[model samples]
Target: MKFRILLLFAVAFLLLTTTRLRVHAQSGKSAARPNIIFIFSDDHAYQAIGAYGNKFAKTPNIDRIAKEGALLNNNLVTNSICGPSRATLLTGKYSHTNGYKRNDRTRFDTNQTLFPETLRQSGYQTAWIGKMHLNSLPKGFDYWNILPGQGNYYNPDFISQPNDTTRYKGYVSDIITKFSTDWLDKRDNSKPFFLIVGHKATHREWLPDLQDLGAYDNVNFPLPSTFYDDYKGREAAKQQDMTIEKTMRLKQDLKVDADYDKDWTYNRFDPEQKKVFKAYYDKISKEPAEKKLTGKALTEWKYQRYLKDYLSTANSLDRNIGKLLDYLDKSGLAKNTVVIYASDQGFYMGEHGWFDKRFIYEESLKTPFVIRYPGVIKPGSKVDDLVLNIDWAPTVLNIAGVKIPSDIQGKSFFPLLNGTKATAKVPWRKEAYYHYYEFPEPHHVFPHFGIRTDRYKLAYFYNGADSWELYDLKTDPTEIANIYGSKGSEAITADLKVKLKQLMNQYQDKEALQILAGAKK
Candidate 1:
């Protein structure tokens, strides 16, 4: 009797949905299988979005998506680095499982089930149009035109498959968005489409769009309290390679033709380009290069550089996102299409006196996640349940009615959109597990793993420094205080530590366990 009633309810719901869809369809509105557009940005912090409560950066289009659909406050990356995060998202697996853990790491195995590949198999057109930084060339797609690793902001070279590699002399943001829009503009109308638009903006040693270099020149930005952090509290955090004062490059880091050592590591520049580059920095610096900027002044300099460059890069992407959204509505794909905006990993923006992203800190741990699936999702909704980047593929597949592969580690959060609480609310991993493997290069972030519960977070730094740092998110969200050995929280710490171990084992992260244990000893 119960089964019959449930079946009847399902039939009735489908009938009502079809009726509504038909009404819209006949009135010059098309109701077809939803198109999926994932707009991904690079090294953008979760705190930088205006909708995410960043009073500093302005991201209107991203906010528009949040307002139109839902804002997932608790989205996290499996691995906090760029390539690993992207791999996890693609394979719905952890770094160990996916086997791509860092920038120079191995490629994500193409044999792994990918959402795009699944979509293609299900009769959807799949195209990737922009920066895809996997160690291996992009796989599992019909069309791809991607920039080589850490693509240039100017005169970037793109490797379009069928082996057509070419250089385009323009801003990376403009080119990426243009090509993405072009793909959409030329997609087959017979089948639904899944497009991945990845941007290489807001990455290291910030470079602003030429038009945006002077946007915030006059504004004296405030410095984070930890701006001059001397690696005081946690020994593990202090030894990182991602300091704004240290890792952040000066005029020479960016290609400016001036004096000083003209060598920019990780960036290639012509020998003759030195004079113009140094002169650019000389003009931009508010104070003479030799003069030391101390206290708040130094902090403000970093903030200004960060804001101007990051925002400038973001500006083009935002306008492009607006372009895509406009295309959906105008092309009559809006209501049925699902649009998502996210980042591979979160970056640090003056918080904790850092610039790069790698640590499991809040700024770097959480990435921006926005979704817009018109008919099924409530406009302007928000969810606070913890969501992992790995789960994104599963959710995409679920929405498209594709089978979630057994190999995928993360489960779908589609229930959250169906007006139901996150299935993870109960018996779901009460704590999130994280790991960072890349050592020395880029950001000398120590390899670590830990768990983040709703109210507290405990991380175990392995290798050089073996200890745990616990933070009460409710009482101290800034993470200024580490009460790892504090009294009265031992039981909670112990419990969380056990949960962390269990999660590690469950995720085939026995390696992290061995490291954590060694570090603890």
Candidate 2:
């Protein structure tokens, strides 16, 4: 009887020891894998963020991320459109490779490998909340609640798994923030998570929340210096229909003489919401008709109205960001979480008389990127190296210590943030590739593919028009002067063309190569 009692005690002690060891191992693993929150907004330009030098822009939350971590100044995109840019971000590949080139009639090819799937397979909880512009439903996320196609700003409908959609009352930005925090609260405590907080603010036909309406009314935005670009040597610029003078509709864009009841966007608002919205816009709508403004005066008026509405809409987006940051801090997740802020792509805020973003020009090419990883990234560090949207997926994977797939075209810039002695010596890319395919439909901007080096840009407009444009970015930062065939510029132009062809080959862009060959002929 004494021997049996001693044996039982020994077994119980062994079991307890093993349990503690297992728990300790699990806790260590969780500590190694930090949570990632990617806040991606639509059409938010780099120039509009306060950290990027927009004095009047009220983006304190986004600015806080910059102050705390790194701001990537030269972050560009593979394609400068909505759906395609999102696809590139997910796959870490270009639009052509992902088979999602244009926003219309394009379904994301889910058969291809996605970074989220990699993360999930590696034991991370993955979820996406808010605007997912991809036509198809999400595939790899453990949980997803997304807006239905360019989601309405008011009383938006959200689609969850198994084809369930529920209408939620409140502004879209606020609703997204609520859903994001709610998910974080309910996520599995044992595993680290990756969440994409997508926002649909500041898109076309900008509509602000009731509180944010007329927020920027008093400040008259100055017109861009190139607002009246004559399209001197740029054929594509001449052909685009995104100009403020002709393309902007006073009634639709500026809310001048708007039919709120009949318009679909305004109809989404409840009676009280509509009343408040109408009260503010009604004051501005009367002026255009009363003054009989036309031509340049009318165009400038439209530009001011556009800026006000766009910035006002952005106010809600910024506020929601603050909400997320506060949640991280309050919940004790800030220390072990990586927070990143970026836009789908850059938008033109009256730059070169354009409003939409389809050009490979400077304004449209560069998007805003700010990241905060508490202990890893130094506060107020700025990365001026060339980084593309495609690199986003690989970078996130690297942050979580997951292996980036070899098929992904983008190289991770994780070394730029990790500050490890080994990774600090790793080299970064010197150039970026860009392609814009949606054309002659919504914006009349021709299809083009280009390469941007540190100090030069070379683009070839194809399909509707065949032309080559080259700009020495050092001398012509605005890209107003094209010196493709200039006498003294021949050597630099030839070198850029060679580099462009090499980039096309590197990316396996067969279509671009064929177009380049045709141009040569």
Candidate 3:
């Protein structure tokens, strides 16, 4: 009887040990999945970053991502508009297919398969915290605290799940950081996490935080060489209403002679915030009236003010990025976490005498994209491949070990990050396709579609401005001269047109195809 009792005890111990080992192995497997944090900013120009060769701009925190991992030089956008760009990101499709081509009154089709839902199904906790301009409630996120449509820079309101909105008191950048970290702290530890820290900084009417008001006051920016563009060949350029001279308002945009009590932008500021803001701007407001500036002098002054305000507003954005990086390090999540920094679309920083985005031109087309995926991507790597905003969703899904749906138009550049021989060496697309649909409203940039190769750009503008513009990018890097129908450019123009049509057909852009068909007739 004693021997039998001892045998039973031994068997019970063996069973318990096996169960513990199985559970431990499962936990290890779960922990191996990398956590993803996408730090998305609004209208952040690539030229305004330190990593992208901006000597004057102080973007150390964003530069850190480039230093640690990869910086994509030619990361272009599919449709260079605010809402449409974001919709393309969520769906991994172009603007037309995603059904959110323009920034006006269209709602994002939440019923469609968003990449976040795929991540969640694969056991990752997904969330989006900050500005999401898609005029609808977030559907796939487990938790989302989004700004209500072009959120204010000071004391903004965030919309949560079940349509709950709470006012947060602080600079918009700072508030977004706090809420993001708070969510990170409270999330379930067992599952891997994916968070989108959407920022409204560096957008239109650039308003800096109180501490950052006069940050760029000492720095004098030089005018862009093409500041006084003749718009000789490009009819679209001549028709645009986005130039800094004419579009940017002094009292409203630059805050010269601003009404503290009446202006909606300033009314949200609390007493202490208001006092600091008023003290700074009131002193600067007297410049225009005192100088009685006019002609080129007035235009140049506006350019200086625009750069100062825009860069100042970006200060808080970079600082908050540092905060998030610090948090990841402190929490021991740094090793397995992937941090990505990018913008909705690139903005114009006195490039071509413009202030806003929405063109297939270099400044507005190519945005900043940096990623830090430790242990996988080699440090200080630079990818000059033609990756688009549509690729973002598939890349994120790939990082989470989730299967990308067949409907997603983007191919994952994950292989590019890892530098794997098998997939990385696969032939990538040589030419990038671009289309802009928004017409004659905010910027009045005419609707256009085109293809950009390494050495050339060919575009066809329509809707009352029927014209074809081609630039030999190798010679005209600044795109000063359009060589369309030029003596030597017939073959290249014909080639680009054929390739553009092929891309449109491949992407299943029916509307664009119809438009192209009509243009040909």
Q: List runs of model 1 lying over 4 Å from the truth.
A: 1-31, 253-282, 289-300, 422-428, 517-521
Candidate 2 differs from the real structure by a C-alpha RMSD in angstroms, to one decimal, of 5.1
Alpha carbon lDDT at 166, candidate 1: 97
* Residue-wise C-alpha lDDT for candidate 2, range 1-521, written one tens digit per residue: 99999999999999998887665343222346789999999999999889999988999999999999999999998889999999998999998899999989778888899999999999999999999989899988999999989999999999999889999999999999999999999999899999999999879889999998889988989888899989998888999889888988888888877788898877788888888888888899888778899778888998888888999999999999999999999999999999999999999999899897978998889999999988678899888889999999999988787889999999888777656424346777777888889978898899999999899998999986788999988988988999888889888888888888899999999999988998942
TM-score of each candidate structure, all chains considered together:
0.88, 0.93, 0.93
TM accuracy, model 1: 0.88
**For each predicted model, how many residue pairs clash, with residues at least 3 apart or on different chains?**
11, 0, 0
Lowest lDDT block of 10, candidate 1: 253-262
For residues 245-337, could you state the per-residue lDDT of candidate 3 as single tens digits? 899998889998888799887788899988898889888988877899988899999999999999999999999999999999999999999
